[model samples]
Target: MRSMPNTNTRNLHELSADIAAVVRDVVATGEDAVITDDGTEVAVIMSMADYDRLHLYAELADAARPGYAGATEFRAMSISEMLDVLGVHPTVDRGLRG
Candidate 1:
């Protein structure tokens, strides 16, 4: 979805009163409204799905980096060897497995 670029910056007190309206607009328009504190960017209001997707993508990106925890080490294995190690037998006649 295309998002509108309208952003609302506010102090803590004004933000408390209008946060609901800002969040509603973000959800309705699939956009993020920036919230600031003491002239520094503090938070953003966005659609839940968009936020989740961005968060998941960041996690995946981090997981894809070298030395990331729980990252799969596949450089030393052939496809057939990987499948065998994973206990997945290939039923089809494809050249690659796993």
Candidate 2:
């Protein structure tokens, strides 16, 4: 989904009166509709596809920052090794046998 710089504005009453129509327009054009109340923007409506794409972009950006990396690797390890990595002690017997 692409970013829509040009947005349409609808007053609260107008949105409430014909919500389906407004939402249809938004989905059809892929443009956001700003819902305003008392001349102040209160909310926005956009298509689910656009919202998901935007959310993914934000997640990627957050992961790109230092110390914000996500867990993308997996490996098998022993219980003791897992405990050591977690910085904790195993107080109960895990029933592991050699």
| Best-performing candidate as measured by TM-score | 2
lDDT of 2 by residue, 1-82 (tens): 2222547888998777899999988887766798888988778897887577545645554455456556566454543454
Q: What is the C-alpha lDDT of each candidate?
A: 0.58, 0.64
Candidate 1 lDDT score relative to the true structure: 0.58
Instruction: Output the TM-score of candidate 2.
Output: 0.62
| Minimal lDDT window, size 10, model 1 | 89-98
Per-residue alpha-carbon lDDT of candidate 1 for residues 1-98, written as tens digits (9 for 90 to 100): 12223455557657888778777777776556777677776667767775665456555555555786875663554434544544445453333211
Strongest candidate by lDDT:
2
Total clashes for model 2? 0
- For model 1, the stretches where C-alpha displacement exceeds 4 angstroms are 1-6, 70-98
